[model samples]
Target: MPADAAAWHAWQAHQHQQRQRAAAQAAAARPSWTRRLRPAPPAPVRAATLVAALVAGLAFALLLGDGMGPGLALAALPAMAAAFTAARAAHRKARPWTLAWVAGCAALLVIPALRDSAWPSTLAILCTALLGALALHGSRTWPGVLLSPLGFADAAVSGIGWAWSGLHAVGRGSKERWLPVAKAAAVAVGLLLLFGTLFSSADAAFADLLGDLMPDISLVDGPLRIVLFLFGALVALTAARAAAAPLRWDRIEVAPGTPRSRIEWALPLILLNLLFAGFNAVQLAVLFGGYDKVLKSTHLTYAEYARQGFWQLLWATLLTLAVIALALRWAPRGKPGDRRFVRVVLGVLCALTLVVVASALRRMDLYVDAYGLTQLRVSVAAMELWLGLVIVLIVAAGVFGARWLPRAVVGSAAGAVLVFGLLSPDGMVAERNVARFEETGKIDLAYFQSLSADAVPALDRLPEPKRSCALRGINDELSAAGDTPWYATSLGEYRAREILRERPVTAPYEVCSRLGSFGSRIEY
Candidate 1:
């Protein structure tokens, strides 16, 4: 009997050794990239992640049902918290730049709570999402900056796998441990329902209080709420996974283009510079020589000349950026003289492009002065300004080393967006138009009608019927919106409601009709 038992133990030890060898062979057979991928998190972390995702989902379903407002910030809180928790659990340190990007995302999310303008709100939401992705898996390289959003796809796949594995684990031994707790919860729920129903039936006020506390889930809203819940859970899970194990986008190598001779690089750029100089000279002449000289030379009105060339100049400036990029790619890199030559030529091109940027902006300014300010005009102008800033940063990068250029450019863009939101662009448009109207006795009432609640204060400054007429659309919207919930409240909407309540639009239709074409002009 002792000899038989010894044989059985030896056989079991041999089997365990064979299983370990097979596992090692399987691991070795994996592709290099697959081997580099992060392993699944520990069981405790997985359980925590699942709980966090469910909480985030619940927050989203509750807070995000309303329009864009403070509720967006509230809904995003759980996901951000889960990301931080997962990162900490995985022993990943948050870099300073990543933290800054996260802070910027938080600030951008708050913009929608402050302003009701469609453009700013939309931009804020979009920028926040991009920034959030960058916070998770940001790279300092230009390629990485451009490709960081791809992490979302990776995270989604990883998150789904993580969830499936986690659920399977829970179904194994975890069920037995949780069974008693589940039973206890079921009993507690039963008791609460019985007692709550009896109390509610006994007191009218208690029933009203209970009704007010509970969410009104209708048949149509039920599916939508479920969808929102699922979406939020997915987002939280993906974000946590991304924070724990960020994709190494910078590791994807890009080979440099073949270096070119100095003549091949310098000649075309010199000619481009001359062309730019000639155009800039004409622009300068038109700028300093006034509208009379433009009329004499082009036989066109100031506004017409400004309008005709601004779009073309804008395109030229954008193309110049592309040209500079390509030129740098093929730039000579052999000698000291070659480096200097590259810098001088590309610097000249960038300088000339700056002139073009200035010309485009000047033309836009002249056009805006001629006509009233619109959302399109303001948006284009802001874009032009940002592009010019990019060119300036390129020049700086050329002078200094370009190691920081990619991240700097991205940071500038985010800063520009933040500044744009803080400035309240819709308010700026309204104020500018109002000032123009006061100066020239011309106003585009139809444009004013399209402005959001952010423009209310400026529109309130208008005289008599024009003011009421300008505010009628916004007022009607606010009236129809009825009462806003606290979570869904926005500063712009609240202020507009208050202003309208104090001084409602009085006989807007009659006044607007009496003014006829003078009140609102059709924009061509």
Candidate 2:
């Protein structure tokens, strides 16, 4: 009888081994892409994900509805914390630069809470998102910088599956432990209900206190709130999952362009360089010769010439950058002379392009002086300046080697954006225009009307009617916004409120209408 039992156990073990071997073979036969999905998270990670999701959901639903203010910062906290926690749990060591990127993202989220201008706030939010993607899955390669947006898209699309997996893991935990906890929770709820109802009925003050302590839940908005909660939860879960297993975008390889002979590459660039040189020579002559020379040559007013050719020159600068990129790709490297020739032609082209950039900037300066500074003018000038910086970086790479060029370019751009936001662009514009007004006794009252609350301090410097006219739109917007919750208040809005309260717009219409026709009218 004992022998028979041992024989039966042996037969079962052999069958089990055969089944396992078959399953392994089937898995190996599956497509390569199918194997790329990460394995299911462990129980501890699943539990942490669930908790983080709940926190994110509550934060988003409660704090994000008021406006773009401290609420944004508050809402981002849980997701950031969860991402860090997941990284630690997965035993992933974050690079030092990644922390800097995260810190930058955090600072960006605070920008909206400080400034009320649309462009600054918009840029801050957009930059924060891009930086977040970089912190999560960024690589050092140029391709990685270019492809960071796609990483975010991939995470968002996979977030639902990640959330479901987490929830399922939590649900599959031990029933016995949860059962007793559930029973205890039910009993506690019953006891609270019974005593709370009796106490409320016995004393009106108790009922009032209870009502004040409880959150007000509306039936009408319940569905919308639930959707918001789910969205936040999904976001948190996906971020945690992504941090645990980041996509290696730097590993992607790109084929270099076909190499060409020195003549093939050098001929076109040489002609392009000649064209650039000729244009730059004329620009330099006009620059040094003053508006009289421009008037004689172009038969146009100085401002007209400045405005007419500035946009074209900017486009030409951009195209030259692209041409340089293409030229470098096909540049000959077979001989030392070939390399030197490539350098001379490209270097000359770059130096000439710098002149074009300078000319474009000079033209914009003249235009601004003749007319007045506008948001568009300031923004374009900044862009042109950055493009010039990019060219300089390219030149440095040509001399010093280009291994660091990609990251340096990306870092410079991010720094430029941060500086732009911190500068308070709208306020700067207002200050410039105000100074111009004081000097020439000419202002654009209508243009001032379009500025945001960031310009409040500058506009306050204006006298009487001009001040009242420039501040009317901002005043109206603040008044319409009413008394927002503390979490939704911006520094710009708060200061504007205080200023307007102290010196309210008295006789706004009469003073504004009288002075409106006096300032310079901006055509575009």
Candidate 3:
């Protein structure tokens, strides 16, 4: 009986072994095996990262070390976007949401801080794209909830780094997370103050350094703008093509079959950044506050400034190119998170904006007597508030997000005004005036000229003495700085008060004048 039991156990063991062997053979015969989606890591290229960092440092020295504030600020947008894009791509299961976030950040940079625009179409696009990417990519945290508020967070009283860093912190939070932001803010402020101090000293020591080099050298052939514009165009094309490409699940971030050597990856980017940094440094040394420098010294009122603006634009284009080149290089060539298509579209849009804005900026300073009552009363800030808001909203809706936002904002603002008019004590007389200006530019003139009792009361309410005094100050400034010659012939009755009285006029006369460009004037 014991022998029979042992034999039965041996037979069972032999049967189990045969089954295992059959299973192994079946597994080996299977083709195109796949793993359930899992978290992955970026390639380990330590040397490339180090090289990129070194190159960025050199760029900081060449460009940002000088006393240019706005350039640095503008440059930070693309730079941060590039870094975010690269970092997000370094992962194996690359997130599409990260690309959306990057685009949103880029859009935010374009939103003029001084303008009163709504979240621009560009901003909306960025936000929507980012949100979509995040949604598709599946990250844990909402980045905009934390970062978007930074725009409004800027105020002198907000944080120590607010003055320097631009990102005003509300207060301290997770020390590990907040520490980098705080330090970055401090460094920015420190560098700005230091540059301002050094520039002040340099200007006093080397007067020639303050002058425009273009006039002296007559370096006419080296506009560099055409090259820049063309380069920008190419980048834009690349981005467009890439963005046009699809975002398939299979196309997500995965390991490269043959990884690039670190030095090889970084060399092009480092050198490009260095070139940009140097070019921008030269631009800073020459600019006189504005992109253009009006040189009255050469007996040249030829708006020597426009030339300067052209040069600045040229450099801006070059710097933009350098940044993109760096971004492409540092990007894991052929990696998953590398949204080559999305970036290409953005690059084109960026170039277009730069060209349009630079053209407008060049035309701005040419207006004659622009410092007078008209320009002062209707400030750029006021116009920008409405126009920028509208542009921003529309752009966001049409280009980046749902196309309904622009319609909603426009409808809302108009509806509010209409409702206010129906309920107002003034019976919407203000609307009448607004309409008249847009249509006829008469400005309630007939109503006032009829000697309406309300007109005189309204004029008196304006505090004429203070108004006249301010107008006089404006006149004096215009005389000294304006391009147009004041003409008594153009003045009408009430507008020609001081000049007519001539009663030992201690201040300048108040008279409406036209704007002009160069040696020309546009009389009304």
Candidate 4:
């Protein structure tokens, strides 16, 4: 019994020592009291750190917004780099494609700065928004492509969430970091003001120097700048966070599709194909017969016949693209017959659409030939040509290509726009109008005068009276403008000013004098 009692005591003692040792080790490994008292940083606090860095970028972009040139291009870099980095950090798995997407977006945004064309800039802004959607969903289907605008909207919402979350995190830790910084800033400012006042009172020279150095800060302007800073910072931060944490569009539930029989799908497609074929047949006759047949059939003049069909055909082409996209999405793809029917019908529709596009182009050419070429007409013509290219791509992809069709479509559209931008639409409009006037002996001096500086070189090619009138008209219009900042001054306007300075001023001719100024104020 005595031995047993001793053994039990030893066992109990060993267990006590083991518990003591564990408690000691755990206590040693535990965090300090200061850390324990501190609030846990929020998940979105990292986004706050990112936003702080982006504030500097936003300021630089704002500063550079004054001019469109290398400055604008340089301004785009900070936002581009920030977005790319944030996206990578948020989604490491989405690295490869994200890099390409961001790079493409950056290039598109920079083109307008380099080329100084409105169309490219508009396209670039659109492409950038689309890329933001692409970054989030990582899909290239109809839902992804079509819902890009929605995705942008969702990103804005998500960004607000992130910013609020970040602010919460910052609030919780304000005592730790923010208070110190605020206190230091306050002390520094107070000291500067106190010393500044003392020096001003002590020495008139110092006061004069100080007064000269310190700009007159307008109360209204100062507040406006502050407001702008906050606005810009919020926007930049929101975009950064949203890019890092993209909203998934696939989460939105869609209704399950009811499958249709092959006949149900084939009949409509067949009817549509027939309608398109009939239109194409008529178009062929009209195109082959020239504007004469169009005038005869419509019982109208060449301009009326051409003008009426151009807009209608453009709408038809756009509607056809949408229809094809929908058909591809919901049409029966499970059965061989259905697939074959879709492929054939869509292919034929695309081919016929190409014919329509060609007819439209022919009509636009006739109209431009009769009337003078304007920016709208030229842009529309370019679009018509692009539509034809899209149709050809659709036909080729449907027939021969199997994969990457969406990418091909996107690339082709982008390529077309890039080519058009490089072509310089303003210059083309000027050249074509000048050439037409030269041949037809009908020149609208007012129209030529209204053209931007891109048309200057082309306008300079005209004969003496026309050249002098055109230059004078443009110079008069440009010179009468109200004061504008350097950033607001476009490349076209700058070049036009240069042209005006370089060329000699010519007195108004009888023709130039007879036509009164189109603008309201007759400063001339």
* Best by the lDDT measure: 1
Question: Which 10 consecutive residues of model 4 have the lowest summed lDDT?
Answer: 34-43
TM-score of 1: 0.86
Using lDDT as the yardstick, the better of models 3 and 4 is 4
Candidate 4 lDDT tens digits, 1-524: 45644564465456446645655566567665423322221134353344454553555444443435444555445555555555565554665655556656666655555344466567766776566556544645544455645745555555666566556545544254467766896899899999999999999999987875543335656555565455555545545655665544434445646666677766787888899889888877766887676677679987878788889999999898888766766678776777777788788888788888888888888788878788788888888887787777777777786455655566566666666666677778888878987798786767665565567778888777667777776666667763334444556666766776787547466656665324332211
| RMSD to true structure for each model, in Å | 5.9, 6.8, 27.4, 12.6
TM-score of 4: 0.72
Query: In each prediction, how many residue pairs overlap at the backbone (N, C-alpha, C within less than 3 A)?
Result: 0, 0, 29, 2
Q: Estimate, for each residue in 1-524, the C-alpha lDDT of model 3 and write its tens digit.
A: 45644564465456446645664566466542312121121222122222233333333333332212222234333323333333433433435544444444443333322111122222332443333333233333222232222212221122122111212111211344446756996899899768866776878644344332111222453344334333332322222212212122332233434434445644654564456456445444445444334344334444444433533554454455445434443454464444443243334434343443444344333421121112221233222233334434434543565335523443333333223222221212323333434454333222222221111212222223322332342234334433311210111112323332342213223221111101222222
User: Cα lDDT for residue 259, model 2?
Assistant: 82
Taking the tens digit of each residue's C-alpha lDDT, what string does model 1 give over 94-152? Answer: 78889888988989898889998878878888888778888888677876788878888
Q: What TM value does model 3 have?
A: 0.23
Q: Taking the tens digit of each residue's C-alpha lDDT, what string does model 2 give over 119-165? A: 87787788777777778875677777777657666666665665665
**Error at 283, model 4, angstroms:** 3.1
What ranges in model 4 sit over 4 Å off?
1-69, 91-96, 115-120, 157-228, 253-256, 287-299, 396-413, 472-490, 504-524
2 versus 3: better lDDT goes to: 2
TM-score between model 2 and native:
0.83
Candidate 4: residue pairs that collide: 66-487, 67-487
